[model samples]
Target: MSKAVKCLILLAVIALFFVTELIPLAITAMGGAIACGLLGLIPAKQVFSGLSNSTVVLFAGMFVVGGAMFYTGLAQFIGNKVVSAVGTGENSLMFGLMTVGTVLSAFLSNTGTAACLLPVCLGICASAKIPASRQLMPLAFACGWGGIITMVGTPPNIIAAGALSNVGLPSFGF
Candidate 1:
């Protein structure tokens, strides 16, 4: 068959997979790569190469470092001191949430930072008789926005930093 025909077939198969929803996303991803290999769409080696990409390694390393910080109770200690000084009003809570998100994202994934603080924000909402869904979004959004200010703040930033490093630009120094 022609390359165009094979491409169309692959596209149809992917669309069908989505429509049918029979396979888990992980399985679908792997199976898609395998299918491409079997169909000779690209070399199998190319498909697996991304698994060892430098960016992936950097991400895993940062997460482990962040986990160590959490495991040592350093994060909790700092949070306690800051919260004590700042008070637990809505603005304080918002700033706390945003700062936590920013600092944590500097050493962890932004999504991970958000997931970590979500419970705390919810607790504040419960105790203060406020709606959690409202306050937490701004806090989370601010963290997400603030993450752009540093290299290690988010995976995309890390990747950008790495790309800059490749071209001799100074890194954001984490």
Candidate 2:
């Protein structure tokens, strides 16, 4: 088969695996990368290079820390404190969550900030007798809005800066 057609077939299989989740997502993803290398779609050495990226490490670390916070009940504790401080009204809850999410996302990865705060928001929602669905969308929107505030706030921002520098333009600061 032509390489392009083979690559497309491989991609389709990966997408199917991702959607169906018959295998663990990480394993499926890694398997897909290895398959591409074995199929001669890409140089083998480049297949794992993405794992060494700083952004990947940052995200992995954040997820580990977030999981630790949830396991230790720190997220619950913080949620209780926020609920007490802000009161349980829907507007109040949204304001508190969005403010926190925006600030956190402005300084950290938006995805990481959202992941870390999800448990805290869930805790807050549960105690307030509110549906988690009500608050979750606002939290995501807050993170999206905040992610544009700084150069390092999201992967897209970093990529944009890199693109600019690659084209001989000045990169964004901070």
Candidate 3:
């Protein structure tokens, strides 16, 4: 079969597996990648090339930092301060949470920012008697917006910068 046809079939299978969720998404993705390499659709080296990408390294480092913050109760301390500063009104609380999420995500991965702030957001919601549903979506949207504010804020931005450099175009600067 042509490589393109093989790739299409592989993508279809991966999509089916993802929708069914019979196996972990990570496993399904990895398995599909390996199958492509084994089928000669992609180079073996290329298949794992992203493992060592700088963006991946950055993500790993940020995950560790976020985990440390959670373990040291720093996240909770910050959460408390933010909640107290904003008071119990739902609009004020939502605005504060989104602003924090956006600011943190501008310097760190959105996933890391969300992870670090999730418990704090939950605590604030519970303590203030605000339903989590009202604030979490805003927090998520703010994180996404934050990613566009800096070159290193998200993997897609980093990847796009790399692609530009590969094509002999100047990369974006912070």
Candidate 4:
């Protein structure tokens, strides 16, 4: 079989595995990359090169930092203050969650912001008797929208800046 066909088949299997919850998504991703390498669809070196990229390093650092905030109870403390300030009304709670998520995502990785705030949002939901489903979507949407406010807020912004620089245009600052 052609290498492309083999790669496609491997991807399909990976998707099936992901849908079936047969293995962790991380493992499935790594295994799919390995399979592509073994099938000669992508070089092994190229597949592994992503691990050393600065973007990957930044993502890992942000994830650790977010986790540290939670571990140190800083997240809880900040969340409690925000919740108390906003009161227990459903609209107030939703506004508080979106505002916090947006502000954090503007300065940090969106995923990292979401990770840091997920527990906080859940706690507020539990305490206020608000449905988690109602608040989580607004939080996520706010994060996405807020990431567009700064050049470093999302990967696509960085990629666009890099592309501009490659063409001798001024890169985005801050």
How many clashes in each structure?
0, 0, 0, 0
Where does model 3 exceed 4 Å of error? none
Alpha carbon lDDT of residue 94, candidate 4? 88
| Candidate 4 TM-score, true structure as reference | 0.77
Candidates 2 and 3 compared by lDDT, better number: 3
* Pairs with steric clashes in candidate 1: none
lDDT, candidate 3, 46-151, per-residue tens: 9888888777887788778778878998778878878788888999999999988998889788877876787789889998999998888899899889978998
In model 2, which range of ten residues has the least summed lDDT?
58-67
lDDT of each: 0.73, 0.85, 0.86, 0.83
Give per-residue lDDT, candidate 3, residue 164: 92
Error of 2 at 90 (Å): 3.3
Please give, for residues 1-174, the per-residue lDDT of candidate 1 as tens digits: 987799789878877887788887777777777878788888978877776878888778867876776688766675566567667677776676677677666566777677766766676667667677777788678668666767766778777777889899887664
Find the 10 residues in a row with the least total lDDT in model 3.
111-120
**What is the Cα-based lDDT of residue 100 in candidate 1?**
69
Cα lDDT tens digits, model 4, 62-145, are 677777878899889978987889987888988988998888788777867886788899998999888998899999988888
- What candidate 1 gets wrong by more than 4 Å, as runs, is 15-21, 61-83, 162-173
Segments of candidate 4 deviating more than 4 angstroms: 89-93, 125-137, 165-169
Alpha-carbon deviation at 41 in model 4, angstroms: 1.7
